[model samples]
Target: MSNNKMSRPADALVEVADEHLDKVLHSMAGETAVAHDDQRTAVHALVAKRARVLVVQATGWGKSAVYWATTSAIRSLGGGPTLVVSPLLSLMRDQVKAAELAGLRSATINSANVGDWDTVMQNMESGDIDVLLVSPERLANPKFAQRIVPIIEHAGLIVIDEAHCISDWGFDFRPDYQRLSHILTASGATPVLATTATANKRVTADVAKQLGDSTLVLRGSLARSSLRLSVVPGLGPLERYAWVDEALGRIDGSGIIYVPTVADTERLSGFLASRGHRVVAYSGRLEAGERERVEDELRANQVKAVIATSALGMGYDKPDLSFCIHVGSPDSPVAYYQQVGRAGRAIERADAILLPAETDEDLWKFFATASIPDVDNIDTVLQTLKESGEPMSVPALEGITGIRRGRLESLLKIVAVEGAVERRDDGWRSTGTPYVYDEQKWAAIRTARAAEAELMRAYASGRGCLMEYLQRALDDSEPGPCGRCSVCTQELPLGGFDVSTESVNAAQVYLRGADVIIEPRKLWPKGVEDGRSGKIVGAGPGRALTYADSPGWRDVARVMSGPDLPLDAEIFDGVVSVLSRWRRQWQRPVAVVPMPSRRHRLMITDLATRIAKIGKLAIIDALEVTGPAPTDDAASLVKVQALVAGLHLKPGVTLPTDGPVLLVDDTYRSGWTMTIAAAILREAGVPAVLPLVVHQLP
Candidate 1:
């Protein structure tokens, strides 16, 4: 792989490719596009020699132009539709609209528009669709395979946008993306073009192997002169919000503020809104229309900024996104680059600011452990499928195996990529592919990711030139300092790491009032005891003061969760304040009941005693634990059974019979403990139970 990896086979073909690019540009934007030599070389490969091409370039470089130009050239010569395997639904929608502008008929088949899938398939079969874009996950879908895979097999050209996802070594590797290999193997002589802006040498090599042995990888200088980078260090979660709130007025135009977790998006966006900045929260959890609406709002500059999780960045087209601010640094520099690249794509200059938090590394490790497949879990899934000799839906599998839904889904995707399992229209079935735990391979990957994480930490600490640091991490051809970043010029944006006292106080107040709701479980885990076989009834919602290491009340949560310690007066006051606000949402509880915990009984009891005193409510011990606590690693049903068997409304107790009671606990994890406690109370004739906890594990 070289910066100049491909050359024109002949002068005439170059001329034709350049002409096609010009046509694509004129049709798409009615403006002339500069003929980057590598772009022409890629188009020539698709049009003339029909070669496999992989392009690794900068963010603002027009990777889409190469494929659109080739599609136009190939279609002019009577070729069939070009299949594009895109990652995100938002990206696919943007691509389809862009294709139409480039004089090509394009339609997407994704999870969101099942209704449009049939019509789009018909168009593809009828040759009316010149560019057919499908998400990588769709290729693995049984229904999509039965319909579109056949048509796509004969596609004139295949383009994989954001091609870094094809590599297991990629910063944002997706297991569903491995299905693209099936297409590559099946599309006999069709020209293939894969493009991405954020792949290192290692990821590039892996993706090229997936493309083909002979694939031409065109590497380019990843120097984005338009992006001026800076870092604001040592900001707590609340302080970060305050800094953004105060800086909104100074920031030039609408941009994005990236947060580490989905929950933070809403919290940050809400705080910014209260400060009189028009903003919206964006996350993958949002519905398709809502995500699109947010994207459109940001693009139109109708809002100050979109406080979002990292999912909002990739392939989102905003020409003049003025600033890219991060509340916490991502685990890797590649991921950080991919995110900040969303800005300055069509502008003279854009600011990329990072506010690094101390909690980011722990979050990275947690998410990493969650995504990696457990050997025993994978074996259980495969062995169960083998014994059943029939397709098993994900829910059925979960019931039988007791793997949680989220982890099970992630595991299946990873195994499916290895051909050890297959998902069909009916359900998932084993493919008889023996599951081997590749210790060496997995260890190597972990090592690589660990190195990348350390590199990011180095970047945050200002070890070297910021631009050169990113370029080197990405293995850019020309890695050099831009001489415009905070480090090089000894300047910092947004007040040089000092936030206003007023703003910080305001943020702390807002955070203290924000309590995350915990929805009660509706259905018992399958395979539980006969007494717990159906829908859960008589359970009410609950609330947690802090979740997942939120800095809102970090010290308070620590003190509350510690063993046998009395609740601090300040902590008790915060709970009272929360109770004051939560009172509106529910009927005032007549009594305070401490949800019995063997380990933290004194701590919880102390807190309950104080709350009982404050609310002028009767203090009662309505529930008590007799049996052992649930095994931490046990299945959901087993955990439920442990709690159910142990938790008995105290042997002889008189309940309030009509009013709700505050069920106080120190921590909430799994929520089964609280659910069973509430069910016991309701069975004993209490009308409702309101759970209050200090910490909620994510």
Candidate 2:
């Protein structure tokens, strides 16, 4: 197990046994030749001696080939199976297919394939599996961890794909990836291979330290010569969407349009389709089958583009993908580079353009905060679990503690690593281990994030080579201008594409027509079982122009903020447009009622009066704000209580006993206010309440 025994000369190329190596190479490349001798030699040496290695190569540099070849070489020598901890299901699917082509048996155990886990395990036990791909989250499953103990004990090699996720400095860091270090420690002398295309000096050094001092680090240049990089900054949301729609027709080959949010994915996809483009929306919200189908469509060039969020990222193999356009900038240069790398992999040249919006910084800040664990919240969760003295499911914990479900799960994973909690079949329980909140670690992460954001701003605005700037930001050894970027070639434009006034107007019209559906709460949140908090009755469908629609609705929502701000013409037109489109959904209401607002009474009154005037319905004063305003940050039950006590029927108003009424509000968030308002109206003898709002927060 000595480093010396496992070491090979840096300059020496080890000749691997040709019998199995040649077969693997032919199967992977579809030819009887190997591309990179250095990569092949390094992987072969690592497999032969069972040594730890780190491969820092650019995307499309055939990193997968190295691991597949290593698996084949080791298995040929009568070694145990290779375990690959992939980060995404798409990556696993691609890897499994590639392994099969290389004549290596591969199977995956992930959330999507629970029904096939038994079969996979059977194959592994019977020595029919050469590589077993599992997600990092799978490592946290107690049953899977227990079942994989023997396999890991004798694993021939452990490949950590997307290894940057293991480091805190990495842009896509996940708490579940930390579990791999523990597994590595338990694997004894098993050789490990970690790979990433997006890591700077800090992230690489951090990962190397975690892997051990004996780990051989192989670093390569980060520049993608085939990618032609450019940026079109300062585009408003509507203009950006318009530009993307226009550019898709000009860009060669099918590609991807990356947005930062799920809402944008749908909005942009719909807008593009309205403009006569064939595209699909791909996000985390899509079902597994849908995602697979979209991936297939993209591979077969059946669509012009797939408007997607980051859910389509990391190991989605489309060899001829010719372009990648970002509607908004990612938070960091590393992530941006990794995403842009998806294009031009097997081609001579491709386009990588960014349309940075004014609101991208705000979106980045919100997501960055969401990822960091809050110190006080973590303490509160740990104390609650300790007091319970027994395992509690996430639902029960959400009831006892007021934290959101997603944040709570993230905190639990962090504490589990610190030995302060453990996940059991029943739920999660406190482990009584003393845990110190690492203020310094989080502070450093925050500082690094700020620096990365600043770097992104430079990338968007600075006069320099975009590819070289990214390379330098990633600390590439030989960072220099690629002579292919918009700046380097003196072809930088204020806009990425020629968007006509007609296209812009069409985009605006589409945005104005966009409406979000507000589904009634069928069941109340747990722990709120009182009469007022149970299943809502007589709740009809609601409609809104958009939910936190960036750039498009920013001005419209601003007008709804203060008491004196008048409702502008654009917002009024937007409301009119939404109502016209939603006419079929609810038809015309018999009456209109304004939900009283303490802050935006004027705006709400104006909106309700306009709607009533347009629909030729009688306007009625139905509800009043009777209590002090509820804290916006309060928990759900607290907000519900405030709304329940605050809203009441007007003292002298007569209710319509058996007709539908349009309930109006300036904005909708959490749906508590609307729920309580509808319940009040229904209790006051209205047959149905249909909620309508100008804006809804997503």
Candidate 3:
């Protein structure tokens, strides 16, 4: 077995016999053509420069091949071992399997060590390993430092997979990744290589800055042309289950359903199984053996779909998957995009579905509640690790306590927190393995959330479009009205309608939680006078009316009877404020629109209903809810009214009301226009007033 190690072949390994390359590519499963144009360019760029490279490549672009090729090239030239720092243990295992399959000698040091840690250390020290694969946390370990660090220093190339972790602001933050700079600096003479699938401009710069002497190689198009994006809104529990059934029924290849919680994953898996679909569930709590069995099923194509949380996609690459659906909204767009990316990996047509629920506001609020873990939690986590007699690595700390990286650094700052955990020069250790999962830390998070009660309240109840807000935040470019989003395709009105004559007189107060209370005057002290009493009244359900007085008030109208008519702008503003509040308060779905007048309330309603049905709620604030007056029997009446009031409808499209209708108009006066509009709406065979208006004067 001593001679079993495959020596590095000379001459850049000569494409591994072409047949071998074909085998490697085909192993990716179903993806026969490796037409990754960007990846090819990036690899060539690195090879030509003979410089250390930081390659930011997207998933399924064959990033693994780039490293394998580069390593083979260096090896042929008598280069030393290539040290690869990967994220997951499973990835290390996969690398080993792939290397063995490729006729190479590779070894990995991780949790599933076949021998004791000391034996593994001796093997690496003896230089028996050709390619060494270690976890990010392993690189920071004192034990690893004492023995393997010297071996790694002797290596000529260092490869970091999923290098985006180094960019603190990126979606997958790991505190151990922050230490890569130190590790690379200490590696003495080795040139470094980096890779990842997701990163923004800021994160990209940070990766380069942190990895000294690095040449950046970015490959592949961010666009997933093969996948179709669809959103189903307003679906109840039964509808959600049916939707999943339908989506799965439509696809032939394997599929995945990503839910936000472990409980949901289990529930959905059971429900689907009851329906006779070969389904499985995977989550963090599952035993490793059980988890692997399910994964094997997915890889073997024995299961039609796997209902899981975010943990399912890492390490396992399945190209035949038709699509991945989000049973509920993810906490952020970064996460949503990442999960959705798993589908269509082989560049085939796939679909991503978003189903929102009424409790969505609560979930969104939960995100806001856990303020980046306070300085104390960091301190506690670090101090606990240090106090523990065992010399633990970063992953050990994280694995034991489940503390994420973004909050790790800050938590480490408190006086109670210890600075760094290191092995004694000699390596063996004593005091204690001080880690404890602090219940108080969770308590503090909850307290912080409670303090911001009003803000959360607004978020849960406000409405417009959830996807729009998520897209603007996640993608650098604007994805205006994705025609298929819950907001764009909604068929019912969720916002209360406004029927006012004096175009601007009827104020539209967008609301979350269905109720709001406002003090009449800003300067009034508590108990000085009874607070201004009013109802958030409007034509649609979520939309309402509120009062406000501001200078340069446009199109002013004095109220002769009803509470002082606030401008529609004021009402819209109030709605936004409430929604923002609800997001922090109850974690409800909320969106705010600036102009509540003239906009079609029905469109907003339909969008909200759809979102609620799908188990996702969003607070979207838009200015264009108004439509124009119809001129002919076939014109879009909603568009006609929207145009008359100069409402901001998404550009270049009219409401999809079927059939021509008679036109009707009236000056913005008390209920005059609504009365006329309603009469005409009935005559035109329009089933109901499209849910969009500032107010319908009673």
Candidate 4:
């Protein structure tokens, strides 16, 4: 049956071998016409020419076609061989199937076929396989490298799918990707073609860096015009199910709902099924048959929706999906966009909704706990791997009890000691075990952990358009309000704080009181700013400012509502009330004075406690730290200094010096430590010192 049929060529989105181009098109005749845009064809032609390229396509933009078609064309041209490095098994399977359907020979090499390695290798050596699909781990095989040398010499194309995985901005990262450029260079520097559906410019650059030079970039637009975005607030896990019910009840056509955890998927799926809605659960733990059945149902339109995690639509090509909902916030915007992108694949109007849960705070907390693994953590994990002497998968490490994916990944490098773990064709393995924690490396990890935590917290707490937050997080450049977040919507009232007109300058100066000259407006206030006080404005453009700075920093006043605690307080009724009542507010935590001022310090502590019980605010301590607090009113600022100090120094250690400080004396005729401490703190570059004298000083 050696028949070679030429079919009609599709437009730009796909360009097959002149011999098989028509066949590829004919094969896809009823499967929705492949997009025929110029960018698609040009990118394809470039790949066929063996030119290194970076193609950025939007959601549902058909980036896969570019790779598949070009590879088929190369096979026809007798380009020795080609390899497609994909991030997921699903994509590899689909690609293999598509190539076979188009009548081209393609074979996938992954752990699933580890038992039949000889068979796959024979096929590769004999040239029976035109295209080899592999995971990054495959690069570790010495034999694979030997096999690819000839192919590289013949000028083969290496396609890195899900290219964003190489970038820090990507939700999923593979350490093997960091070694990709070197791997290719080892094979004689073959041309590279990287593809991703979602990535900002910063991420795009990282992708290229992993591929080496001689790169051609093909970027698409960010606008998903065919999709509509929306959000629902004030919903927890179970309550959110109700909102999902209401939303799905109104819409028709296939859709997907993404949950943060597997437990959530089960609960939501069960709830929907119980309510007589056709739903299925998709998670990594699902059996192969069950996954196939669900996909079949989706293709048959037998199911209305599927409540799943990121595993649902890896290689799914259903075109008529109408909605995509996120039950919880994704840690990063790149991830959110990719997850929701599974919807509206058919060029129809689709909706994407994000339902934020109270517990959604978990994502940020998790991020704070394990944002970026420092060299030390990475070494620790790698050292453990070295001791195991067995290759492992990322998912396997992620499944560890008590350890989060973020922490596990962050620790990999520290353990690996910079590429100590070689990327195996099947999995990752550490080169050797370590005897102890490298103190230098551990210190580096600590420093990085703190910096990353602050960054994540800022992302979560910054008052602005949600879109602005997303954009800024993805790109470090200054971004304006996105005008599309819940905070940006006019219907939602000011959240998370109280509003006031006090200038940050005045409040800061007043709090510092003659210690610092620069009087910035106070950002936290108990009520809205008035004409007589400061004005309210957004800190950055395109961002909302729940509490903006106004004039006469002194004119605006913020009433305290709660006690000054050292940690973030839990959300409660009173906290919510104060947050809702005042658009903005500030909290001044009265610091302790070491001198004899017991009664006054107690009163100040009481005042602080009362304010904390009433509103949303930040601490503005008015005292200098000389020694331990005389009363609770003056607690230790030792930890605070440790936190604010430069990372070059050891943690928990404080430097002694004479700096400007505010002294809090009980109805004092004279201020001592508060003043001296203020001087010391000021000399240490502290902006201002605010003195809270329990009784009026006369």
Candidate 5:
């Protein structure tokens, strides 16, 4: 019995939607799930008006309810299954269960469920599935696109979750989402509804423009009355870790603690765990099962918190997630809003705390240009493909074009969707599609990014009411001092941003004790050193005194990188600490060989001398580079060739043939130096090479 509520009178359809909405709410949220007025209105607009809508509302506003309810009504009216282009795997999982609660059969197609694709497609084709969800990546997949050509043709509704991603102006703009918009542009009157809680006025307008001018834009205030916002600025990395440790003692429920990078996630979560707080480190690095386990742990309140990077960004649903603490500031207010929105959704009051580190701007700067394609990069990629006259994989392109793997793939995807490049069964090839570089458009985006970074600075400074500031930044009509914010009341959660000295000191010990296991390069770079290729073996993981500009030893890091100085007692002790911990995992080394370095020769000599004295091992400073180290580090492939040619065991040097030997370096950058050094050591009859460095440049 299809509700086919579309044929009912306006008042009757609204009432029918209320019934369907409650069932959906009841299934996911339990009974007492009354439909919000806006939820029913949006459903009515989809069913009765057949309108294409964009809903930019705050989190926990039941935006999902509007779509689920409309799907139910449309299906009851003998319409085809609802087609949802979601952005993340977790969201698809959540929505599939949500569809079931609304009494509909649902299935999803994503990378994780490849085995079930045929079953899902069969179910979809047979009209047995009421809702079908696929990620934007799948929408761009050639196979899935071919399969869905007929599916969307009969789809009763098309929903774009996190629709802001369709616009280049979005905080998390993606090329695949833009493809979804193009699909809808041709899907003729299929009642498209795009939803996001993170779009600003420009993004909203851009999304609307993409959906067509007649699309209804329903944007509510960006304010979250349940969120109590505050920023604690000027914290160093150690202090940020300490602050979170201290704050957990006072906070009531399970929540998330966000870090800037995966390293920080490990650092903070380990520190928190040492303090007896139940937390887990989460990032894209985690396997699907592990990530699911962590998510379930948080959902069940089995753990106090999950320390994560932006990899845990969207679509993880936890209504009672009472807090969101950011260890570092986001680059933009929109990003900040999207992350902190995870909190206070179901609870009466949720704390949103920001511990803004001084180093945040550096990371922000790197990411600001990360996804924005550069003319030179695009040209290089295209030219290399043209020169090859054949399709080449991303790795081959990286080796040839000198672009890094991640950035190269991102560029390829953008250009592929734009028709400048095409992906084949084997790899990617140049399509010669003219890239119309809209200089003005790109410049405006860059300027907007800079402006948004400044807005985040303002947000972190408490320039105005926190809620009102975010609302205004997003162009929401909502304005005013949220009387409960730290700026308005001069009150702060977790006792006014003061971290315990006990925790800070513990953080120091923990940071010093943490192991920096540098994974040995798995395979030699192709297109370098006469195209060395094959699995790298007999090279075990290396240890480091510090990784990057470690918070616990930033001062020492600066001196080591800036000045050619001998190791200080403090830094030496930390190195010993790292060695003490790392030794537990590897066989003891019998000798120490300092990596050849011209720039920091004195420091390297001193470090080798100290290791020789302390560990009582032979100091074999036998290997040497032939010429001045490359003045500038080039791409991985180029640098490998330069380093391999120059870096070798000194002519006729005696070598150790048994067990692992310690290879020491003052620093590691691009890793080519250390990698080549280790390979040289192995070839010279050393069974294994264990590298140790003062700092590993990030």
Candidate 6:
């Protein structure tokens, strides 16, 4: 297709679209002179008829251009400002900039801009803004919802970016996105456009159904001609790290390394940096400003790669990102496609490599279950609110129902959607609306997820052409072998990267030194006794090697803690190395103490004695287990209660009056055991307690 033909607007809309296309090109610094015909069609569909449309196009296909141009065309027609329901802050930031470049003033209302909400609203009311971007979570905000109603009634267009999030079948389904259905109903005749790059047939149908009847669905080819897909499966953690270190030098340009967890991002980033790669870690945990800084660095090629979680997955605008390497397989092929789509956007032949690990399934299960709401917990929350007959704050609910604050908040949102509960200024109150548990629906979702997981496994194992397998998994119409992937051509350029023996050994050494920081629990959990529920005073920072970190200390720690397995010299040496590195940040302890464990007392004692010997400190038996340990899956309150009842000071053993103590344990989970132990020692006159654990559980 010629640029002239692609740029030519449809009849009757040619002049207006040409003007808007020029504005978009200007905003993009004249990167291209023509907009795709699909882009022009989407724009005209919105401006000419105020129609609802779904555009499922490949990444870098100018989906953003369609919306920005549509906003421009609508404003020229004296239409109200457009509203964009984006899924992430990163996406919103990019959209706001694009809107400005397209000659449309845009402002965002999200958690990061609480102070600027008033200013944004004022701009909207004064006709100073042409587009308003918001996160799905903002729709649930009572204040924002009330304030946005007037705007919604007159909105020129509503764009749901990453529209796959609205489908339960999507890998990244979010309940908050479901709130859009209500907004659509209230939006009346306002034009709506849903855009996404990764959606299977099921997700496409679901999203279209949500947008109402007669929604124009425009889906383009899912194939990315610029992407070269391959899989390097069965690599352990250390090997993967070494492989990345070696591969980074051979890759074409700056790129991203996607990990399955936050800890993996930090650990892998550190390992790569140690191997002389300029890299940084990016996760949801980072502050907004810090995330933006890292994004800018990647865009400018200041860093070779940013080891990131899915938090960096959507709408990160680095047009020339040359490669995307996954340390572990994503839960579904659709998600993997979406992430790999970030690369090869504006370049020819970007590498997309997947290094699947044995532990990927475990991570997938953890994440899948974490998002599904617990029926019992939801019912308990609703019943409590109903009994109260008034609004109650989250903290108060925590006290009444023993649910952790985070889980409680999630449950509240679920119930609020069901109309069983409502949020007010004070807190949350029940609406007396009876709610039925949707067991069948949840079961179907679980079944579908299991199938997706199997499909991911098949993809990693080279059951067929990599691209074709993914396309079929997404139910794309034109599924076929690309003839460029490793499987189809029997050539693997990604796996051809060489790793020296020295690099592999260095990676192993780095993995062995699995030191991790154990953050102290500052506030005691609610529903506990007042004496136990206040601020924990003498707790200090703690350290550990790894948290179930596979193919590393996790294996060693498991063997050492198992029945009849003794601590070895090599494991002990690694512990010493971790402590040596941690000592620089920690105050030198005056003494060392051990927390008694029912299953691993001997291992804990050995570790403590070894650490004390190395540090030249006294080994004190400060606390002993009074009863059995709590179950691994026990709730936070249950764990605390069991620890409080089971742990006690050793007979005739008094802690020092004014110096820090090294409190050692075999492993750390909920930290209740360490918390209670530290409290006991502190009450006995110890000034500060620092926790050291061999392994930490995620």
List the global CA lDDT of all models: 0.83, 0.82, 0.50, 0.53, 0.82, 0.82
Q: How far is 479's C-alpha from truth in model 6 (Å)?
A: 0.3
Candidate 5 ranges beyond 4 A from true positions: 1-34, 529-531, 627-633
- Ranked by TM-score, the better of candidates 3 and 4 is 4
Candidate 3 structure quality by residue, lDDT tens digits, 1-698: 01112232422333332333444455533356563555454444433333456665545767777666555544544566677888875567667776665445687776556465676666656655557888766666655666666766667567877776665455565656556545654543455677776665556677777765455546434555555565566565445565675556556688789987775676567666765789998897887567768877887889999899877755567776776777767655555666777888775566766776654566667665443454455455556665675655443454344454334433442211222433443332324434344567557535533433333232122244434443433333544544543345553221212222221221111111223222111121112122312231222112222212111121221331333233344444443454444334332323222223333344334433433344343333323333454332211222223333543334442221342221111112233233333333333343333122222221
| Shift of residue 46 alpha carbon in model 4, Å | 3.4
| Best model number under lDDT | 1
In every candidate, how many clashes are there? 0, 0, 112, 72, 4, 3
Q: If scored against the real structure, what TM-score would every candidate get? A: 0.95, 0.94, 0.55, 0.57, 0.94, 0.93
lDDT (Cα, 0-100) at 631 in candidate 5 = 40
Candidate 6 local lDDT, residue 501: 79
| TM-score (C-alpha, index-matched) for candidate 5 | 0.94
> Model 1 lDDT vs. the true structure?
0.83
Most TM-score-accurate candidate: 1
On a 0 to 100 scale, what is the lDDT of residue 57 in model 4? 71
Which clashing pairs does model 6 show? 514-545, 516-544, 547-696
Q: List residue ranges in candidate 2 displaced over 4 A.
A: 1-22, 35-38, 493-497, 529-534, 550-554, 649-654
In model 5, what lDDT does residue 501 have?
A: 87
Global local distance difference test of model 5: 0.82
Clashing pairs in 5: 2-76, 3-76, 4-76, 4-77
Better of 3 and 6 by lDDT: 6
Pairwise lDDT winner, candidates 4 and 6: 6
